[model samples]
Target: MLGQAKAFSSFSTNDIQQTKAFYEKLGLNVKVEDMMGEMLIMQLNGGGTVLIYPKPNHEPASFTVLNFPVQDVEKAVDELTAKGIKFEQYKDLNTDEKGISHQDDFAVAWFKDPAGNILSVVKDK
Candidate 1:
Protein backbone atom coordinates (compact mmCIF):
# COMPACT_ATOMS: atom_id res chain seq x y z
CA MET A 1 0.00 0.00 0.00
CA LEU A 2 1.25 3.46 -0.85
CA GLY A 3 1.61 5.64 2.18
CA GLN A 4 2.25 9.37 2.28
CA ALA A 5 4.16 10.80 -0.68
CA LYS A 6 7.77 11.56 -0.01
CA ALA A 7 8.38 14.46 2.29
CA PHE A 8 11.89 14.78 0.89
CA SER A 9 14.65 13.10 -1.10
CA SER A 10 18.43 13.26 -0.93
CA PHE A 11 21.39 13.58 -3.29
CA SER A 12 25.11 13.26 -2.97
CA THR A 13 26.89 16.53 -3.65
CA ASN A 14 30.58 17.00 -4.14
CA ASP A 15 30.61 20.47 -2.69
CA ILE A 16 28.26 20.82 0.20
CA GLN A 17 28.67 24.59 0.42
CA GLN A 18 27.69 25.21 -3.19
CA THR A 19 24.97 22.60 -2.88
CA LYS A 20 23.57 24.40 0.14
CA ALA A 21 23.82 27.76 -1.62
CA PHE A 22 21.91 26.59 -4.68
CA TYR A 23 18.88 25.41 -2.72
CA GLU A 24 19.08 28.39 -0.40
CA LYS A 25 18.19 30.53 -3.40
CA LEU A 26 15.02 28.51 -3.62
CA GLY A 27 14.28 29.64 -0.04
CA LEU A 28 15.44 26.31 1.40
CA ASN A 29 17.54 26.49 4.53
CA VAL A 30 20.51 24.29 5.21
CA LYS A 31 20.20 21.92 8.11
CA VAL A 32 23.76 20.89 8.80
CA GLU A 33 25.28 18.76 11.52
CA ASP A 34 28.88 18.09 12.53
CA MET A 35 31.25 18.75 9.59
CA MET A 36 32.09 15.12 8.89
CA GLY A 37 30.76 15.22 5.35
CA GLU A 38 27.94 13.21 6.77
CA MET A 39 24.33 14.11 6.01
CA LEU A 40 22.91 17.56 5.18
CA ILE A 41 19.35 18.74 4.95
CA MET A 42 17.92 21.48 2.79
CA GLN A 43 14.42 22.57 3.67
CA LEU A 44 12.20 24.77 1.58
CA ASN A 45 10.33 27.61 3.21
CA GLY A 46 6.79 26.25 2.88
CA GLY A 47 7.20 22.71 1.58
CA GLY A 48 9.40 19.63 1.47
CA THR A 49 13.09 19.36 2.03
CA VAL A 50 16.07 17.29 0.67
CA LEU A 51 18.97 15.47 2.21
CA ILE A 52 22.43 15.84 0.65
CA TYR A 53 25.44 13.66 1.34
CA PRO A 54 29.03 13.76 0.27
CA LYS A 55 28.89 10.23 -1.14
CA PRO A 56 25.89 8.03 -1.61
CA ASN A 57 26.29 4.74 0.17
CA HIS A 58 22.93 3.16 -0.60
CA GLU A 59 21.48 2.51 -4.05
CA PRO A 60 20.80 5.39 -6.38
CA ALA A 61 17.16 6.29 -6.72
CA SER A 62 16.00 6.02 -10.33
CA PHE A 63 13.19 8.44 -10.02
CA THR A 64 12.27 12.08 -10.38
CA VAL A 65 15.36 12.87 -8.29
CA LEU A 66 13.78 15.96 -6.74
CA ASN A 67 10.45 17.62 -7.21
CA PHE A 68 9.48 21.12 -6.11
CA PRO A 69 6.13 22.77 -6.61
CA VAL A 70 6.18 26.45 -7.46
CA GLN A 71 3.67 29.17 -8.13
CA ASP A 72 5.31 30.24 -11.39
CA VAL A 73 7.84 27.96 -13.02
CA GLU A 74 8.99 30.76 -15.27
CA LYS A 75 9.55 33.07 -12.35
CA ALA A 76 11.28 30.30 -10.51
CA VAL A 77 13.53 29.67 -13.49
CA ASP A 78 14.27 33.34 -13.99
CA GLU A 79 15.03 33.90 -10.34
CA LEU A 80 17.18 30.80 -10.14
CA THR A 81 19.11 31.63 -13.32
CA ALA A 82 19.69 35.10 -11.99
CA LYS A 83 21.31 33.43 -9.02
CA GLY A 84 23.50 31.39 -11.45
CA ILE A 85 21.57 28.13 -11.52
CA LYS A 86 21.51 26.61 -14.98
CA PHE A 87 18.40 24.88 -16.20
CA GLU A 88 19.11 21.75 -18.18
CA GLN A 89 18.65 22.34 -21.89
CA TYR A 90 17.44 19.63 -24.19
CA LYS A 91 16.70 20.27 -27.83
CA ASP A 92 14.15 17.50 -27.86
CA LEU A 93 12.39 18.64 -24.72
CA ASN A 94 10.26 21.74 -24.39
CA THR A 95 11.67 24.00 -21.72
CA ASP A 96 10.82 27.28 -20.06
CA GLU A 97 11.55 30.39 -22.04
CA LYS A 98 10.90 34.16 -21.94
CA GLY A 99 9.92 35.77 -18.63
CA ILE A 100 8.26 34.10 -15.61
CA SER A 101 5.44 32.23 -17.31
CA HIS A 102 5.57 28.79 -18.89
CA GLN A 103 2.20 27.68 -20.15
CA ASP A 104 3.63 24.32 -21.10
CA ASP A 105 0.34 22.78 -20.11
CA PHE A 106 1.46 22.52 -16.49
CA ALA A 107 4.10 25.26 -16.29
CA VAL A 108 7.32 23.45 -15.56
CA ALA A 109 11.10 23.62 -15.77
CA TRP A 110 13.96 21.21 -15.08
CA PHE A 111 17.42 21.96 -13.77
CA LYS A 112 20.21 20.64 -11.66
CA ASP A 113 20.87 21.75 -8.18
CA PRO A 114 24.45 22.72 -7.35
CA ALA A 115 25.04 19.07 -6.61
CA GLY A 116 24.24 17.92 -10.14
CA ASN A 117 21.09 16.31 -8.85
CA ILE A 118 18.20 16.45 -11.29
CA LEU A 119 15.31 18.59 -10.07
CA SER A 120 12.15 20.03 -11.51
CA VAL A 121 9.73 22.79 -10.60
CA VAL A 122 6.12 22.49 -11.62
CA LYS A 123 3.02 24.48 -10.90
CA ASP A 124 0.59 22.74 -8.61
CA LYS A 125 -2.08 21.09 -10.69
Candidate 2:
Protein backbone atom coordinates (compact mmCIF):
# COMPACT_ATOMS: atom_id res chain seq x y z
CA MET A 1 0.00 0.00 0.00
CA LEU A 2 2.86 2.37 0.65
CA GLY A 3 4.60 1.58 -2.61
CA GLN A 4 3.16 4.62 -4.31
CA ALA A 5 4.39 7.00 -1.66
CA LYS A 6 7.43 9.05 -2.58
CA ALA A 7 9.96 8.10 0.04
CA PHE A 8 13.42 9.51 0.50
CA SER A 9 16.44 8.66 2.60
CA SER A 10 17.51 10.90 5.46
CA PHE A 11 20.64 11.10 7.58
CA SER A 12 21.88 13.27 10.41
CA THR A 13 24.86 15.57 10.38
CA ASN A 14 26.57 17.56 13.08
CA ASP A 15 27.12 20.59 10.89
CA ILE A 16 24.86 21.36 7.96
CA GLN A 17 27.12 23.94 6.34
CA GLN A 18 30.11 21.59 6.21
CA THR A 19 27.93 18.80 4.94
CA LYS A 20 26.50 21.07 2.25
CA ALA A 21 29.96 22.08 1.06
CA PHE A 22 31.14 18.47 0.96
CA TYR A 23 28.13 17.32 -1.05
CA GLU A 24 28.37 20.30 -3.35
CA LYS A 25 32.03 19.51 -3.98
CA LEU A 26 30.92 16.06 -5.04
CA GLY A 27 28.74 17.71 -7.72
CA LEU A 28 25.42 17.03 -6.06
CA ASN A 29 22.55 19.48 -6.38
CA VAL A 30 21.92 20.60 -2.82
CA LYS A 31 19.73 23.27 -1.30
CA VAL A 32 19.13 24.46 2.22
CA GLU A 33 15.59 24.39 3.58
CA ASP A 34 14.31 26.02 6.76
CA MET A 35 12.09 23.25 7.96
CA MET A 36 12.00 22.12 11.60
CA GLY A 37 15.45 23.64 11.43
CA GLU A 38 17.98 24.25 8.70
CA MET A 39 18.30 21.11 6.55
CA LEU A 40 19.80 20.11 3.23
CA ILE A 41 17.92 18.51 0.36
CA MET A 42 20.09 16.68 -2.16
CA GLN A 43 18.73 15.84 -5.58
CA LEU A 44 20.12 12.53 -6.74
CA ASN A 45 21.02 12.18 -10.40
CA GLY A 46 19.15 8.90 -10.83
CA GLY A 47 15.98 10.57 -9.48
CA GLY A 48 15.28 10.87 -5.77
CA THR A 49 15.94 13.18 -2.87
CA VAL A 50 18.02 12.73 0.27
CA LEU A 51 17.32 14.73 3.38
CA ILE A 52 20.24 15.84 5.54
CA TYR A 53 19.37 17.24 8.91
CA PRO A 54 21.51 18.51 11.73
CA LYS A 55 21.67 17.04 15.20
CA PRO A 56 23.78 18.20 18.12
CA ASN A 57 24.82 14.70 19.12
CA HIS A 58 25.09 13.18 15.68
CA GLU A 59 27.21 10.07 15.30
CA PRO A 60 28.41 8.80 11.96
CA ALA A 61 27.03 5.55 10.65
CA SER A 62 29.57 2.75 10.37
CA PHE A 63 27.96 1.27 7.28
CA THR A 64 27.60 2.97 3.95
CA VAL A 65 24.66 5.32 3.84
CA LEU A 66 24.67 5.97 0.09
CA ASN A 67 26.04 4.32 -3.03
CA PHE A 68 26.60 5.72 -6.50
CA PRO A 69 26.63 3.17 -9.30
CA VAL A 70 29.06 4.12 -12.05
CA GLN A 71 29.91 2.70 -15.46
CA ASP A 72 33.60 2.68 -14.57
CA VAL A 73 34.64 2.31 -10.96
CA GLU A 74 38.25 3.19 -11.77
CA LYS A 75 37.33 6.41 -13.47
CA ALA A 76 34.98 7.44 -10.71
CA VAL A 77 37.58 6.67 -8.05
CA ASP A 78 40.29 8.56 -9.92
CA GLU A 79 38.11 11.59 -10.48
CA LEU A 80 37.00 11.69 -6.88
CA THR A 81 40.58 11.28 -5.77
CA ALA A 82 41.59 14.19 -7.93
CA LYS A 83 38.85 16.17 -6.21
CA GLY A 84 40.65 15.52 -2.88
CA ILE A 85 38.48 12.64 -1.76
CA LYS A 86 40.32 9.79 -0.06
CA PHE A 87 39.16 6.24 -0.51
CA GLU A 88 39.07 3.90 2.47
CA GLN A 89 41.23 0.80 2.46
CA TYR A 90 39.89 -2.38 3.95
CA LYS A 91 42.44 -5.13 4.17
CA ASP A 92 39.86 -7.67 5.25
CA LEU A 93 37.68 -6.87 2.25
CA ASN A 94 40.62 -7.45 -0.12
CA THR A 95 40.45 -3.96 -1.54
CA ASP A 96 43.10 -3.01 -4.10
CA GLU A 97 45.64 -0.22 -3.86
CA LYS A 98 42.94 2.09 -5.07
CA GLY A 99 40.61 0.91 -2.31
CA ILE A 100 38.30 -0.92 -4.70
CA SER A 101 37.14 -4.44 -3.94
CA HIS A 102 36.33 -6.88 -6.70
CA GLN A 103 33.55 -9.27 -5.86
CA ASP A 104 31.90 -11.85 -8.07
CA ASP A 105 30.62 -9.49 -10.72
CA PHE A 106 31.04 -6.03 -9.27
CA ALA A 107 33.61 -3.65 -7.85
CA VAL A 108 33.04 -1.14 -5.04
CA ALA A 109 35.09 1.63 -3.50
CA TRP A 110 34.29 3.37 -0.24
CA PHE A 111 34.90 6.79 1.22
CA LYS A 112 33.57 9.02 3.96
CA ASP A 113 31.81 12.34 3.99
CA PRO A 114 32.97 15.27 6.04
CA ALA A 115 30.77 14.11 8.87
CA GLY A 116 32.45 10.69 8.73
CA ASN A 117 29.48 8.97 7.16
CA ILE A 118 30.46 6.20 4.80
CA LEU A 119 29.50 6.26 1.11
CA SER A 120 30.48 4.12 -1.85
CA VAL A 121 30.79 3.92 -5.62
CA VAL A 122 30.02 0.61 -7.28
CA LYS A 123 30.32 -0.78 -10.77
CA ASP A 124 28.61 -3.89 -12.03
CA LYS A 125 30.27 -6.13 -14.56
Candidate 3:
Protein backbone atom coordinates (compact mmCIF):
# COMPACT_ATOMS: atom_id res chain seq x y z
CA MET A 1 0.00 0.00 0.00
CA LEU A 2 2.94 2.32 0.70
CA GLY A 3 4.65 1.61 -2.59
CA GLN A 4 3.41 4.82 -4.15
CA ALA A 5 4.22 6.91 -1.12
CA LYS A 6 7.20 9.22 -1.38
CA ALA A 7 9.66 8.29 1.34
CA PHE A 8 12.75 10.13 2.55
CA SER A 9 15.43 9.19 5.06
CA SER A 10 15.86 10.87 8.42
CA PHE A 11 18.58 10.69 11.03
CA SER A 12 19.53 12.37 14.27
CA THR A 13 22.50 14.59 15.03
CA ASN A 14 23.78 16.05 18.24
CA ASP A 15 24.40 19.51 16.83
CA ILE A 16 22.32 20.92 14.04
CA GLN A 17 24.61 23.88 13.25
CA GLN A 18 27.71 21.75 12.94
CA THR A 19 25.85 19.16 10.90
CA LYS A 20 24.48 21.83 8.63
CA ALA A 21 27.90 23.34 8.08
CA PHE A 22 29.45 20.00 7.27
CA TYR A 23 26.82 19.17 4.70
CA GLU A 24 26.71 22.64 3.23
CA LYS A 25 30.46 22.73 2.79
CA LEU A 26 30.16 19.52 0.82
CA GLY A 27 27.97 21.45 -1.69
CA LEU A 28 24.56 20.18 -0.55
CA ASN A 29 21.86 22.75 0.07
CA VAL A 30 20.94 22.48 3.75
CA LYS A 31 17.97 24.33 5.10
CA VAL A 32 17.36 24.68 8.81
CA GLU A 33 13.67 24.71 9.63
CA ASP A 34 12.46 25.54 13.12
CA MET A 35 9.67 23.15 13.91
CA MET A 36 9.09 23.43 17.66
CA GLY A 37 12.85 22.96 17.70
CA GLU A 38 15.36 22.92 14.83
CA MET A 39 15.25 20.55 11.89
CA LEU A 40 17.76 20.36 9.05
CA ILE A 41 16.25 19.69 5.68
CA MET A 42 18.92 18.62 3.23
CA GLN A 43 17.93 19.36 -0.33
CA LEU A 44 19.89 16.84 -2.34
CA ASN A 45 20.72 17.46 -5.95
CA GLY A 46 18.77 15.76 -8.76
CA GLY A 47 15.72 15.76 -6.42
CA GLY A 48 15.53 14.28 -2.91
CA THR A 49 15.25 15.38 0.70
CA VAL A 50 16.75 14.17 3.97
CA LEU A 51 15.63 15.24 7.40
CA ILE A 52 18.15 15.69 10.18
CA TYR A 53 16.93 16.39 13.67
CA PRO A 54 18.75 16.88 16.92
CA LYS A 55 18.70 14.25 19.67
CA PRO A 56 20.31 14.35 23.09
CA ASN A 57 21.42 10.75 23.14
CA HIS A 58 22.44 10.52 19.53
CA GLU A 59 24.62 7.55 18.69
CA PRO A 60 26.47 7.27 15.42
CA ALA A 61 25.37 4.46 13.19
CA SER A 62 27.87 1.62 12.85
CA PHE A 63 26.86 1.11 9.25
CA THR A 64 26.68 3.64 6.46
CA VAL A 65 23.70 5.85 7.07
CA LEU A 66 23.89 7.59 3.68
CA ASN A 67 25.45 6.75 0.38
CA PHE A 68 26.25 9.22 -2.45
CA PRO A 69 26.67 7.79 -5.88
CA VAL A 70 29.56 9.40 -7.77
CA GLN A 71 30.85 8.78 -11.22
CA ASP A 72 34.43 8.39 -10.00
CA VAL A 73 35.11 7.29 -6.46
CA GLU A 74 38.71 8.45 -6.64
CA LYS A 75 37.79 11.95 -7.78
CA ALA A 76 35.05 12.23 -5.21
CA VAL A 77 37.35 11.08 -2.44
CA ASP A 78 40.03 13.53 -3.55
CA GLU A 79 37.63 16.45 -3.55
CA LEU A 80 36.31 15.57 -0.12
CA THR A 81 39.81 15.05 1.20
CA ALA A 82 40.80 18.46 -0.07
CA LYS A 83 37.90 19.86 1.92
CA GLY A 84 39.53 18.42 5.07
CA ILE A 85 37.34 15.34 5.15
CA LYS A 86 39.06 12.20 6.35
CA PHE A 87 38.30 8.77 4.94
CA GLU A 88 37.98 5.61 7.01
CA GLN A 89 40.20 2.59 6.58
CA TYR A 90 39.00 -0.94 7.17
CA LYS A 91 41.08 -3.89 8.33
CA ASP A 92 40.45 -6.71 5.84
CA LEU A 93 39.02 -4.78 2.94
CA ASN A 94 41.36 -3.91 0.11
CA THR A 95 41.11 -0.16 0.49
CA ASP A 96 43.77 1.82 -1.33
CA GLU A 97 45.75 4.71 0.06
CA LYS A 98 42.75 6.95 -0.47
CA GLY A 99 40.66 4.57 1.69
CA ILE A 100 38.50 3.30 -1.15
CA SER A 101 37.70 -0.41 -1.28
CA HIS A 102 37.37 -2.28 -4.56
CA GLN A 103 35.67 -5.59 -4.35
CA ASP A 104 32.93 -7.58 -6.04
CA ASP A 105 33.21 -5.36 -9.13
CA PHE A 106 32.28 -2.18 -7.26
CA ALA A 107 34.30 0.54 -5.62
CA VAL A 108 33.25 2.45 -2.52
CA ALA A 109 34.69 4.87 -0.01
CA TRP A 110 33.57 5.75 3.47
CA PHE A 111 33.62 8.95 5.47
CA LYS A 112 32.00 10.45 8.54
CA ASP A 113 30.07 13.61 9.18
CA PRO A 114 30.90 16.02 11.99
CA ALA A 115 28.49 14.13 14.24
CA GLY A 116 30.41 10.89 13.60
CA ASN A 117 27.77 9.26 11.46
CA ILE A 118 29.20 7.00 8.77
CA LEU A 119 28.50 8.10 5.21
CA SER A 120 29.74 6.71 1.93
CA VAL A 121 30.50 7.57 -1.70
CA VAL A 122 29.93 4.66 -4.02
CA LYS A 123 31.25 4.42 -7.58
CA ASP A 124 28.40 4.77 -10.01
CA LYS A 125 28.39 1.59 -12.04
Q: What is the C-alpha lDDT profile of model 2 across 63-125, one tens digit per residue?
A: 999999899999999999999999999999999999999988889999999899999999954
| Deviation of model 3 at 98, angstroms | 1.1
| Model 1: per-residue Cα lDDT over 79-110, one tens digit each | 87887777765555555353223554676667
lDDT of each: 0.67, 0.95, 0.92
Instruction: Report how far off residue 42 is in candidate 1 (Å).
Output: 2.0
**Estimated TM-score per prediction?**
0.71, 0.96, 0.95
Instruction: Provide the lDDT at 2 for model 2.
Output: 91
Model 1: which residue pairs collide? none
By lDDT, the candidates rank as 2, 3, 1
Worst 10 residues of 2 by lDDT: 116-125
Q: Give per-residue lDDT, candidate 3, residue 29.
A: 92
Question: Taking the tens digit of each residue's C-alpha lDDT, what string does model 3 give over 1-125?
Answer: 99988789999999999999999989999999998699999988777889999999999888898999999899999999999999999978778999999987799999999889999999887
Positional deviation of residue 119's Cα in model 3 after best superposition, in angstroms: 0.6
Maximum-lDDT candidate: 2
Consecutive 10-residue window with the lowest summed lDDT within model 1 = 95-104
- Regarding TM-score, does 1 or 2 come out ahead? 2
Candidate with the greatest TM-score versus the true structure: 2
